[model samples]
Structures are given as structure tokens and as C-alpha cells.
Target chain A: MPPSGIRRRPGGRSARVRATVLAAVDALLAEVGDEGLTLDAVAERSGVHRTTLYRRWGSVPMLLVDLLDAGTEDDWRAPDTGSLEGDLVAINREVHAALTAEPSVTAAVVAASFRSPEAGEALRRFWEDRYERCAAVVHRAVERGEVPPGTDPRRLLVAATGPLYHQRILLGGPLTREEADAHARAARAAAASGLL
Target chain B: MPPSGIRRRPGGRSARVRATVLAAVDALLAEVGDEGLTLDAVAERSGVHRTTLYRRWGSVPMLLVDLLDAGTEDDWRAPDTGSLEGDLVAINREVHAALTAEPSVTAAVVAASFRSPEAGEALRRFWEDRYERCAAVVHRAVERGEVPPGTDPRRLLVAATGPLYHQRILLGGPLTREEADAHARAARAAAASGLL
Candidate 1:
């Protein structure tokens, strides 16, 4: 076995502590959400000392940015369904599900962004990468001649998925797969019409 | 002058207190957004006692609901631009302006909804009334035969405005009046295409 000083060294010990504390961030978010999330609460939930939490994450806004930044490690990609319509529906379905989840992490993260400019900027980076990934479907559609060249993928994707976010996140209205598909179909038709 | 007890009695006194306290809600929201809002802070800012705040608003969610409820007292109406595309652009301009406001109350209210179920429901009513009012433009469009008789007004409005909210609030991306107009134009075309 390693000596006590070696076992308590920075590298592995710090990583384990960070992983544990960040997991507690999600748990707190799931329960009381971002409003109730505090560094003291995190320390209590994480079983890490308050000094360590303050020394590391420092503030809730910084913690929120870190939490969202972790999402960039995901291997998320847009759906490829051989057509723009199918791809839009597939993408919106995932978004709809995430937004509809009880104690939705997506909704919480979006809410967190509004609480601080730092978190908002981090959320922007996370979405930029996701949109870049999803733009592939538009490129594929162009290659397949489903839509003409110069069809802006980001604009089309925004039109396809925006209503789901608006309905689910802001209006707190009922959303369904049918409604998601309808927006996707509208986007597809508009794209074919050279409007989007 | 009337006696101190009579001067600070229930009727007019309570009304003034409520107004003053609610004004503080907006001040705090502007300075620090919803996450920084607290009853103690409100009491301190408004010169109302914390007990009065607790007895009246009770909780943060209830305060949020009341703050949004105050907006309904406004006599807002959709633009009468005499055309579907014109009206859509007009409505989106208002939405875009609010979301992009420095210390945007619109974004703060939307973010507040995610923090509590009560606030979410209040926001729903707020949006519902706003949408119902905006539906007037679509009725005018239908009368002008811009779209078919059965064209759903709500779907068209959502398509027109959703992307603006998505771009400004969620993506935290750059937005402009021209982009808002573009989405409006797309929704108009989609409505005309009999797809929306």
C-alpha cells in the first residue's frame, strides 16, 4: 500500500474529489435546482470540506460554467436519416425529451446561464459545438440534392428546433412528438421552397 | 394628520406597500437577475419589514408569479400592419428587443420559471395571453386571404417568433432585426404554402 502522504497526494486524490463534488452539483440541481445550489450545500452533499470547494470552484457562477463545460466532453452528433425532415424530427425528439425530463438538466442549465454572464458564455460554446455537429445533416441534404446549395444549415436547424425549445422551456406548454415533427416538416418544406 | 395607526392602516397603506415592494422586485431583478432575488433583499430595498414580505409574497416562487402577474395589467396589442408578413415582423421586433435588453426582464422572467413550478405556470398564462392577443393579426391575414381558411394562427406565430427566442436566449448568439424579419418571412411563406 502507498504511504499516507503518497495516498493523499494531489493528482489522483484531486481528480476523485472533483468528480465527487461535480456529481453533487447535479444532485443539488436535480433536487433544489440552481437557486438552492450554494458552495456550502455542495460541500455538504459532496462530503468535501468547504475550504476545498471555495478554493477550487470559488463561486456558483464558476461552478455552473464548469458544469456546462463538462458537457463538451460528450460525443453528441446530429441524427442522419437520409433526409432533412427525418433528421430534424430525430434531433428535436432528443431535445424535447431532455426538456421534458423531470428536473430537466437542460432546463436547469439554461436557467443557470441566465443567472450569470459567465455561465451564459459557457452555454454558448456548448451550443456552438452542438450546432456545428448538427450542421452535417444540412450538408448531407445538400449533397443528396434534397435542398439546393447555399442552404444555411444553422438557420434551417434553428427553424426546425426553435419551437420545441420555446414551447417546452419558456412557455411551459404541452409539447408532443407530433408537434416536434410538424415543426421539422415546416422547416423541411420551407427549405425546399428556398425560404429558410 | 390622522393618527399613526390610522395612517398605516390596512386599505391604502397595504396598497402602497405592495406597490413599493413589487417595484423593489424589478430593481433587484435588473441589478442581479432572479438568482440574486430574495425576500430579505426586497425588504431591505423597499423599506418594508421582512415579516410583511413573508406574510404577503411568502416565497420566491410566489413573488415571481406576482411579478409576472403585474405585466398582465398592461394594455398591449399586436401591430395592425395590414399584412401577415408585416405583422409578424412587428411582433418579433418587440420580442427581440425585450430579450436583448441589457438586464433583460424577459430573460430573467423566463429563467425564473425554470426555478419553480408556480412561476412556470404564471409565465404560461402570461405567454398565453400574449399569444391570444397576437392571434388577431392572423385573423386579419385570414380575412385578407393571405393564407387558407384553416391556417392555424398559433403554429404560424410560434414558427415566426420561436427562432428569435432560441437565438437570443438559448444560443446566446448574435441577433438582429433583419434575422427576426427573415424568420417572419419564412413563417409567412410556410403559412401560405399550407404547411404550417
Candidate 2:
């Protein structure tokens, strides 16, 4: 077994191996969806042998959970746009890009979550952390008098993101940039009304 | 072969077969989540033969789609509550109940839609049809001058539903009755501001 619980490099491999494995997960998701994604395929695609892959992640579910965890920390740091609308627009755009740019990975993770409590827990934690951070932005807007003092910033943040997820899964759409803009505007407007 | 493209029971056999199959699907989903759900399991649990199951739905995806289509017509119907908020609350409550009550099925259908264009298309039809129907309730609010003119009722409706889906998938929380009420009010307030 490799030291530090990571394999694929004896002495040291750049942290790039993690990224490579994540990309493999993404690619496999795009090709096979959720039910068909397998650890062997990930190992082959990642060019990391089965032993290394197994040592790193005991099972497909564990590997997937790691991949998803990698995704969460990639770009969750939202841009500071100053204005409520500007911040929302920028964040919405970033989220929209992430979900749409890798629709397959996003969908596969969502599906896997349904079957694996570990995946579900990972997703829930990602959201809570992300939402809490995003809520800070909305709260700043309220402090600036851009929105009503009574606005539920947490709920507003969720409202801003709700449509894109809905369209992709339940509503069946690509969640385009235009759609992101519309949802942001609507969420901001609602916040301003002290209703969110 | 049985009549009407489904495996019909022998003459005078009770309609209980279909009901049993559906109940079996629901049970499987609740216990197994999406990945663990399988056609063979459904048949075996329901005490039906594999031939009978295959003759009824053709494939797992087909069975899932049919299972979704069955007994769900009344679930999506919008209520006439004389006000947009009231109507929205009703719709939101129904959705909350449905999701919380059947997380397994909800997760399964969503995951399947990711890989199957047919499932994706069916989800689209379901959303558009239900949203259009729900929009009528919002339009009624406009007629009452409760919301501003030129408001996109459809967008407003989307705002209301967007958070529920987000919270369900990301927050790991239950869709309580209180959340539904809050979403309806937020959606209405957003609409009144011409945000929709």
C-alpha cells in the first residue's frame, strides 16, 4: 500500500492524479450514465490500474463520492460582484456553467445519491456549505438596503438556484445562460419584496 | 398475449395484478433506492412471473415510465383557491407530499432521465403540461391586480417550485408543509415586483 493512502506513484506524483481520476469519473458518467458506471472502466480510462484504484477507493460508490468531493471544492468560491443582482448573476452563471458543462457528471452523481447514503450525505454537505456561503452574499445585499431587511437570505439563495436544477432533472432543459439570468432576477426581486 | 398491450389476467382474473405490480415497484424503490430497483425483484416480490412482467412493460425503463404514468394524474392538478398564493400553496404541498412520500421513485425517475432521452422527453411533457396548468392560477391573480401587469406567470411558478427541488436534493431536509407555504409567499411577492 502506498503511504498517505494514495497509490499510482511510489515516491510522489503531482496532485494531478486526483484531477485525472476525477476527469475519468466525469468521462465515464458521460458515456455510461449512473447505473453503468464502473470502477474498472474508471481505472482503464484514468490509466490507473485496478489495484491503485481499489486501494484509493474501496468501491465504485466510494470512488464516486471522492470524485464528487473533488468537484465541490473546485470553484465554490463565488465571485464578489458588489451589487445583489451582480453577485447573483455571477454566481448563477458559474453554477449554470458547472452543471451544464458537465451535465453527465452532475446527473450521475444525483442518481447515485439516491442509492447510496454516502453519496447523498456528500451532496447534502456540499449544498449546505455552498448555500451558507452564498447566503452571506445575499445578506450583504440586505444590509446595503438592496433588499428588504426581512428577506430570508438562505431561502433566497436557494430560490435563485432552484430553477436550473429543476429544469435539468424534473423539467428537462439545458439550463441555459438566459435561464440563469431570468431566475436570478426573479429571486432578487422576491428578496427585495421581503418574501424570500 | 393479453389485450390492450398489457398482460391481462385470465378472464375473470381480478385487476389486482396491476395494482400488485405497482405496489411492488413502490416498495422496491423505498427499500432499495434507484440503483437497487430491478424488474425481476418487482416481479418476484409481487409474486408475478418474469414473463408476466416482461409482457407488461418490455424493459426496466419502460416499466419505470409506466409506473410513473400510472395513478399520478390527480397528483399534479392545480387547485382553484381564488388567489395565486393559495393555489400555489396547494400545488407546493402536493409536490412536497409526493417527494417526501416517495423519495425512492422520485430519485429513480430523475436518475433514469439522465441517461434516456425517452425518459427526458417524458419528464418535459410532464413539466410543461403541469406548469401550463398551474400558470392559469397565477394568471387569475394578475386578473385580480394582485400582481403587476406583464408579469411572466410561468416564471413566477418556476420560482416557487425551484427551491423545493433544490432543498430536497441539496439540503437533505424534509419538504415540510411550512416550506411550501413559504415558497408560495415568496413566489407571489416576487411576482408582485414584476420579477417573474
Candidate 3:
């Protein structure tokens, strides 16, 4: 085993290995869906040692959870466009782009969440963390007197994004830019009318 | 082979076989999820011949599609509560009950949809059909001057149900009856305010 006393660097070999492994997992998920993913395939595709992967991830679901966690870390800043409507629209647009840009990958990750308890827990945490992070936008809106003081940020965000998710994942509808805009506008209208 | 001239009854042996096969598919999906569902396993569980199963369903995805189709046929009627708000609340409550009552089955079917193109298409059709059947509620509301003429029923319905789905499936939140009522009320308020 490597010495535990050595301080790890941010962009060191360990980070590179993790990045490569996650990328391999992403590719495999896109190609074969979550049901077909295997640790051996990930090892071969990532050029990581099988023993290392087994020791680190332990199972395919754990590896998927790690991939999801890594995905959540990639720049999900709450929009601050001076108005709640602008921020809501921007965030909804971002979600629409992510879901539609790579449907297979998004679908596979969601399917994995439903099929594996570990992945499901990770996905739940991912959404909760995202909601918590984005709650600041609503807080700022409340401070600015743009919305009610007691407005629920998580509920508002869910309302803004839920229809988009329903259209893309559940109903299999075309997730157009206009649809994303409409979702944002609807949420904004509801919030302004004290409907949220 | 059976004679082509013989008329088939609705609930005859063929129907029984289909029901048994679909039930087996549902059971296996709940037990092991989409990844573990197989034609051989379904045949064994249903006590049906392997050749018959192959000839009828052909693949696991197709079998899942059949199961979804069967589910859709079981009594989904729009509530005629004489008011749009009442109807919306009733529908949302039903959605909440269905999602929470048998979460495993719902999760498995949704996962199957992500992993299979055939299942995805079937799921899409299922929602569309349900939407069509329930469009009457909105039409009645329009006729009663509750909602504006030319109101999109599907949009209203999506708004009412999207949050529940996001909470139950994506965010993994507890979908309570109060939450269901809240969703309906929010959508009703939004629609009344011309947000939806």
C-alpha cells in the first residue's frame, strides 16, 4: 500500500485515475445502459487495475454513485441575474440542456438509481444537495422583496424543473428550448401570484 | 394450431395466458428489477411454454411493453367533480396513491423504459392515452367557464402532477396526500392566474 503520510495534491495521479475511471463508466453506461455495466468492463476500458477498482468501488452501483457525485460537482452555480424570473429561467434552461444533450447517459443514470438502492440513495442526495445549493437564489429574491418572505425555495425549484423532467423522461416529449422557457415562466407566474 | 374461423372470446384461454404472463413479468420486475427480467424466467414463473412465450413476446422489452399495456387498460377515469379544482385534486391524489402504493413496481417499469426503446415507446403511448382520456375534465371546465377556452388540458395536468413525480421518483421525497392536494391547488391557482 502507498504511504498514508504523503499529502495528496488536487490534480495528482489519484485524481487522474478517478477521472479516467469515471469517464469509462460514463461511456459504458451510454453504450450499454446501466443493466449491462460491469466492473471488469470498466477496469478494461479505464485501464485501471481490477484489484484497485474492486477495493475502491466494490460494486457497479457504488461506482455509479461516485460518477453521479462527480457529475454534481461540475459547476452548478445558482444563477444571479438580478431577478427571480431570470434566475429561474436560466436554471431551467440548464436542466433542459443537460437532460436533452445526452439522453442515453441521463436515462441510464436515472435507471441505475431505480435499479440499485445505493444509486437511489446517492441520486436522492444529489437532488437534495442541488436544491439546497440553489435555495440561495430564492433567498436573495425574498431579501429583494421580489417574492414572499416565506416562499419555499425547494418547492419553487421543483415546480420550475418538474415539467421539463416529466416531458423528457416520463412522457418522452420533445424538450425544446421554448418548453424550458415556458416552464420557467409558469413557475415565475405562479410564484408572483403566490401560488407556489 | 387453432382454426382461424373460430371466434375468440375476450376473456378466454388466450386472455388468461396473457394475464398470467404479464403478472409474471410484473412479479419478476418487482423482485429483481429490469436487469434480472428474462423471457425464460417469465415463462418458468408463468408456467407457460418457452416457445409460446418467444413467439408472443419475442424479447424481454416487448414483454415489458405488453405488461405496461395491460396496466393501462385497467380503469383510469377522469374525475367529474363539477369543478376544475376538484377534478385536479382528485386526479393528483390518484397519481400519488398509485406511485406510493407500489413504488417498486413503478420504479421497475420506469427503469425498464430507460433501458429499452420498445418499453419507452409503450410508456409514452400509455401516458398519451391517459391524457387523452382525461382531457374531458378540462373540456368540462372550459364549458363551465371555470378555465379559459383553448386551455391545454395536457399542460394543466402536467403542471398538477409533475411535482409529485419529481418528488416521488427523481428527488425521492415522501409523497403525502397533503402534498398531492398542494400540487393540485398550486396548478389550479396558476391556471386561474393564466400561468399554465
Name the lDDT value of residue A89 in candidate 3.
89
Instruction: Give the top-scoring candidate (lDDT).
Output: 1
All candidates: DockQ = 0.50, 0.50, 0.48
Local distance difference test values of all predictions, in order: 0.84, 0.75, 0.82
Off by over 4 Å in 3: A1-11, A20-61, A72-75, B1-11, B19-63, B72-75, B102-104
Superposed by TM-score, candidate 3 places the C-alpha of residue B76 at a distance from the truth, in angstroms, of 3.2
Pick the DockQ winner: 2
Q: Kindly report which residue pairs in candidate 1 clash with one another.
A: none
lDDT digits (tens) for residues B1-196 of candidate 3 = 2654235653476888898899998888777767778888898999998899999889888998988788679886899998999999999988888678643676667777766789888888888888888899889988888877867788888888888888887887877887788778777776776656
Indicate the docking level reached by candidate 1: medium
Instruction: Name every residue pair that clashes in candidate 3.
Output: none
Q: How would the candidate models be sorted by lDDT, starting from the highest?
A: 1, 3, 2
Clashes of 2: 0
lDDT of 3 by residue, A1-196 (tens): 2555235553476777899999999999877877778988999999999898999899999998999888688887789999998998899888887678653677677778866889988877777888888899899988988878878887888888888888787887777887687778777777766666
Candidate 3, TM-score vs. the true structure? 0.80
Across A1-196, the per-residue lDDT of candidate 1 in tens digits comes to: 2567546786877777878888999888888867788999998999998898889888988887887787777787789887788898899888888877777777787887866779889989888888899999999999989888978888888988898898887777778787787788888888887777
Better of 1 and 3 by DockQ: 1
Candidate 2 RMSD computed on C-alpha atoms after optimal superposition onto the true structure: 5.0
